[model samples]
Target chain A: MNDASSQDPEQQSMPPLGADHPSVARILRRWRQLSGGRHTRDPDRKTLVACSGGADSVALAIALAQIPSSCVLAHIQHDMRTPEQAEHDRAYVEALAKRLGVDCAFGIAAVSEEPGNLEANAREARYQELARIADEHACPYIATGHHADDQLETLLMHLMRGSGTRGMSGMRPATPLGNKTLLRPLLEIPRNEIETMLRELDIAWCHDQTNDDPAYVRNRIRQDLLPLLRRLDPEIARHASQWSQDLVAMQEVMDERVEATLMEPCTITDSQWRWPRELLQAHPDIMLGYLPGLYCLRVLDNEGADRITRRAIDSWIRSVKSDSNNPTEHRIGPIVAHIRAHEVRFTPAESSELST
Target chain B: MNDASSQDPEQQSMPPLGADHPSVARILRRWRQLSGGRHTRDPDRKTLVACSGGADSVALAIALAQIPSSCVLAHIQHDMRTPEQAEHDRAYVEALAKRLGVDCAFGIAAVSEEPGNLEANAREARYQELARIADEHACPYIATGHHADDQLETLLMHLMRGSGTRGMSGMRPATPLGNKTLLRPLLEIPRNEIETMLRELDIAWCHDQTNDDPAYVRNRIRQDLLPLLRRLDPEIARHASQWSQDLVAMQEVMDERVEATLMEPCTITDSQWRWPRELLQAHPDIMLGYLPGLYCLRVLDNEGADRITRRAIDSWIRSVKSDSNNPTEHRIGPIVAHIRAHEVRFTPAESSELST
Candidate 1:
């Protein structure tokens, strides 16, 4: 066979009646839209479903199975939980794939139990493993189980941490993971809806007991903050999720604009990036505010961008906008800006002087 | 004398020692920066202070009194409280103004005690009264005591309600009110710092017991949510406040761009506002999203814009951008969108179809 997908029979236009749940139809519609018609005509393509045997992922895998595209179930164990729980999850997922008559892949995550970053580390490990599995399966797309409630929680966490529009904009429906594309088909679907779908369809899903553990900040936010918010506004998650999607779209346009208008015109050498003073002054103040972060992200491309503060950006803007003939040097994250009369040059700061 | 402001003697570069609280100095510094050095050379300008007899406003009045520019304390009694409490507040404000050696104006607010809108009505009445007082006193600027905590609280309320960047941008430090300017010099200062300044300066201010009453949503947020956030992040208010300010600045740029790039180029007749189809297509998707809101705010200039939903905007964008362009009519808030091959036109909708 050319590939797993190429060997599969030509699928019918409509879903099979046995697998046609209303939630499945909705998920298929969203997947088609989010993938930009990738599902409509690309019959040879395959998607690796990252199922943790949760309601959300189980539903996603079920929905993708109804559509024409070939799908394989993939389960990853972070080993953060007890061995019994991890093994149980893997077995459940394997059974699910067998029931659906699809191939299955299982992998163990290599997560470092770092203090204060355990959750982040686990996530990184999981995604890394998912990418590796997708590569092995020759699946160009990896679908996940993230839903509207997850979107709302991420937004709340970002808001509490004083993140700007960038953080509050929430996750994208589709983003690249190494060479594979990561897809969240159920991002806009509410968690309760997914659960109801699984119940109505009589599909069993494994629930992680550790999800309620208060030790995790996300769990605390989910249990404490989300319920209180739901009490206040029943549609809080739906509204916040939609708003986050809008912000993501807006930020995409801004990133495009910044890349074309700012990053393109600037001259970059091995040691320094230079931009004409007039070019910097020509843009609107709002666009000017985006420069520092974009510089750190696109130019430096490292962890230094995370430490870049608003105060630093403001001070740098003030210096650039100032009508001073004298040379001035200001440190912004990992880079040091040298401002002169004609142009501004950015160079990597010395290792000893890299703070803020 | 020319005006209350022009009549006042030229002040010194530094504030008098007695009125020189660190918080006051910080407020003045922010005031100068926000005003674009308006306070540096413009010594002949007068500011009307809106004091509610609370610690925050009382401190504001005390700080402004030490400056050279004419300052007047204006207190508006909303009559929301009991007669005894209202009288007590007015009396306390008058006494504080006397202690500060500045002219004081007390006005009884004409507030409509609308069941659910009592707080909003009271606020509206107070601002109206402040504007009237400022106009009579020939004060070009009206200063209020909206500090960082209030900013954080506003952001939280907006986030809970799923507001876009426009709502979560927080309050501006300076905005035009009718013909006068409204200024919040203490916007960046923390609430506790203001209270500390009052205590250190031995300034007595009235206590509003109703602040602790959970009847008000803001009060509830203050009592329950803010404390929880504080326990999590001590600098939450400060960071969120700064982020809000950054959003406000970014929004200002967006507004300016929309006005120039989109609105200015569009054609508006007596009843219809029209834009070339190609012109709409030429702009970035982000700018297209802003077109509907800008049209409502600048073109219609009414409450219809407030009820406009994101879904409506998205559908409208899709309709306008679609290849099949038969004459189409869509209702957007209080406006009707008419899309044709050559141009898209917006006209006020019938009163019968005013609902979003």
Candidate 2:
């Protein structure tokens, strides 16, 4: 490590450090801190990186390769344009893997012929392929090259689409990718830093011309919306990304309550499922999270069920005084909970509830 | 109603039946449909309009006056600037009220010693005074001339401040204000309509010089940010307002869940409550909603608990799935939930849980 750090005067020009040459080391340190400083076992540590041959993924691959563990390159070939171009991408990733002495896996997926599901389908296919490869190789983790810029773009896209907290939270570092763990080590790293690393390494990467294609929503967001956001505040991308990270962190705390309160198995009856109402009443935030799914099911089951709106919940929560002990069941979405016989049971709406 | 409709040529020109009309009417219709088509007694059967004499407010007042309900005018004297200008506003509103054969009420509030809360304090005082007057004069509803443009500005401001769904939803049509209801019937109407209404009515109103003062956040949003948004999309304000309305609708649904799931009373025994682990395992969404408030309380109670994050929640929820039938207790936020004799209980953190 010391030899590598001392080898280049160009690396020496990086921000001052006692032993670590580049500021990237500090970033990696912070990444560990953010990851709670816990490293999994070697055999269990499997990562599948979504390599796009971009500066971001290239730099990520290089950094992960430095780690003393087996790493695999997972490249997705979205067959939207020329098949030859995708082949070129595979060749580049293979060459990079060859230089690093790591195994590379290339997946070519045909774009869906159906309309409207293009972006969603492509993303789903990419992750599915990565997960499949990881499973086949007995890899526990599937890594991605999504950087700060990507996170910020995701936040804004969700914001524009009028999403709530979960949508606004953006991408996470380690989330379940099917059966495998999807880790994104480069999420906090800026695009510029990744580009710099790629340049310093004298590595060439492919630039997807589709990135500028306004037809795609993500491209439009990248080319048009992001620039406008940057103009509003120069560091907006970084700030938005930070906000997203904070939200995700907050979401984790909320998820705990959900796990603690909502995951009880109940006997499903003809109309409703019996569960302890006290369990739900105890955790307010988790209950709010469960509303949408319940509401969706309720609406589907009973068309006339009153829409469980947000204001109604706020007012109802506010009305819950410290002294209130009455067991109450309010119709929210598809789920109805009523306190009867010393138990709160949640159930679907009756067919009569659906009659307009 | 026909007489009022015939009195205004612009009202006649309004689309008799078309979807192209600014989606406000459709939203109102949908709201009625949701509410079982039973008309709630118009609390604002006789309302006093808080006219800033600006285009937005003026438009709102004009539209409300067109309704069959009796209307009045109310103006607040901030006494911030020249007394003469304040008087001019009072006189303008009085004259407008006189022309419409509606009562007029005027009140003066002293500016706070500190200026940071100037806008908020002023608005609060104004509403308080309006409520008092509404009670005295038997006006069931107090109308504010906040139109679609104001709603859009409000939504943007909330978004910039990183507020959640509740904040981003913007002004509602009818929210309880003490005994009287605060109705913003014109929230769906655009600013252009107000201007057109004023011009058509030949009603000249004074422009508040303070509006040009960029010191206020609303003014800043109107002057600096809105134009940029318009440049990106000319109908940005309209779209934003519409989005706000849609979010308001969505939020109501979420709130219904919060009410039905959370808001249960639990007895505190020595400052600790143990919830049955099975309860949380049943409804994850409800539990998630309780996390934010719980996390906030945990931070106050124990500094070490600050480390409890969203990732923990995700892991904890996953853990619950594995621990089915076997009840376990987990400390989340300020509350602890566990199984004691197969009964779930949630209790506040005792001194020990708070201790580092």
Candidate 3:
């Protein structure tokens, strides 16, 4: 028996399926594609199914049961509800894993509920614990159950909030987390299909009534907006998902071009950087295109962009492109921009004696 | 009399405002801004107000009446309706122009409508006729009455059809039409506002019954989807319009970068072109980024992209970026592509022995 993926003699010896359920077979096929054909071939590479006894994750766990892979169960209680409810979820997940003859890992937490970030904080904590447990079990993969409908809602949320292409791009099917990789094999599958499979298999999963409460904007989007949009066009969800994929692909290409442009024209360093005077003078628009990325790379990563305004970038870009020699200064996220005749430069807050 | 503006005594000397209607006065302010501060300043430059006797355009004509500019009425009848209805539209527009004390120009078209494209054909004919009229009058600007609500619908239409950021960017507040500029001053104003202003001024404009007949898809969208969206989020129209504006700004910045990058690493000619092997080898994503643009510039300009499938592009892009040296051929529009190791080249259909 391998340490990472002990071939459980009891589980493997258990009776094989008389016939493959279409849904289970489909999920197994999808997992094969998502895991890059690793799970079944290399039993040494252990798999962790991240389930919270929710319908989607539970259905995912049941589907994975059809496959012969070394797997472990991981669950986390957000502790947002009563302790009784939390224990129910924990016991439910454990019981489900026991029925499948798999080892179960529990991460019960009394996470602090912040005023405006309850959902996000809980999600982050769960992911952190999932990663820790996966590492403990030497599992290289953690599969979640985010599907196409979730993809659609995500796009609408991003659009309504005036997010650029980056935010509009939906989550990747696979994302690397430290040494482990997290995968969602059901992004192309509809939520109804997941529910249908559970019923067909006579499986039961926890249903949290609070998620459907219209207090959350995403709930309204899911309950009302998506349905209304579907009535408008039956393929709305598919179209929205396709659009997300488009943006994701577009961002990849744009990222590459912008990165190359940055490397060619700018002097990048840990503390500060400057763009070529001629690049700014002749092709100012390209430099303008790189401003958001510049903020990400030089000022700070990711969150630095939210601190800058499109209007400021537009103005600076306009002045650079046009016949304007007027000097301008704009303070953006602890950095003061100095725009002059030839080149635009930046000074860090500490060296420039900027107030905190 | 200036050559550009022979102020007809009969029209100019007709009357002074008893008390300028607030609506008319408001439009005069907008015209000043849209015409680049030249409409009121140079009566000599002249302005053509494209009125269809619809409520929105009639309001526009009424507004233009308050300004000191040489304005003329430009009306087009698609002849899709009964002859009587067309004649009524013409006569009604002429009467409105007379009341506003401006010369009227008619572009009565019995345009041959193609099957499945009645609306588009009519529109194309109308624009061509409007361009001719503007050129004949030496009018530098052609003002229309596309309001914010119209912008919202355009975006929704684009979204339903899976449009890129360019299509989602909505209509420009101002676009150049041949020798003249086309301006839509009310894009920031709602359609109901236009109707309200007309009612306040006690002005009556012809309401084409056909427009309300939900037979048209746009009418259904306006009548159904928009109302539903507004119920879901009261600011749907405003948000959609803002999204369009954001995309417009994004395109402006991206256009410059893509153009510069295209110039480098690609050898172009009238008939065929090939990318720099090393550039494609090292930064294959850059080539993928340029694929759409290459189809545009090397094939049929911007609209050429509509003929290509995103999935096909994604597949080719994946194969190109990944560690696969698969030889592939995909015929896109009038070009046949040969994508192989180290290079991707485009050859014209005509010279490539491709049959019609």
lDDT score for residue B226 of model 2: 63
Candidates in descending lDDT order: 1, 3, 2
Q: Write down the C-alpha DockQ for each prediction.
A: 0.39, 0.08, 0.27
The Cα error of candidate 2 at residue B279, in Å, is 10
**Candidate 2 lDDT, A7-45, residue by residue in tens:** 333443442222232634644454344334556433346
TM-score of each: 0.89, 0.60, 0.77
Question: What TM-score would chain A of each candidate receive against the reference chain A?
Answer: 0.88, 0.72, 0.84
Docking class of 1: acceptable
Q: How many residue pairs clash in each candidate?
A: 0, 49, 0
Per-candidate Cα RMSD to the true structure, in Å, reads 4.4, 11.1, 5.6
Q: List the residue pairs that clash in candidate 1.
A: none
**Clash pairs (backbone) in predicted model 3:** none
Cα-based lDDT at residue B81, candidate 3 = 76
The sequence of per-residue lDDT tens digits that candidate 3 reaches over residues B1-356 is: 22122444454444423125665656666766777764356564467888888898888887765442467789887767778887888899999877766778988655554565666766778788888888888888888888877888887676666665456568988787767888887776777778888887787889853354323567768777777666656656665666666556555555655656654657767656777544555643433555555666555654545566655566656655555667776666555666777777777645676543
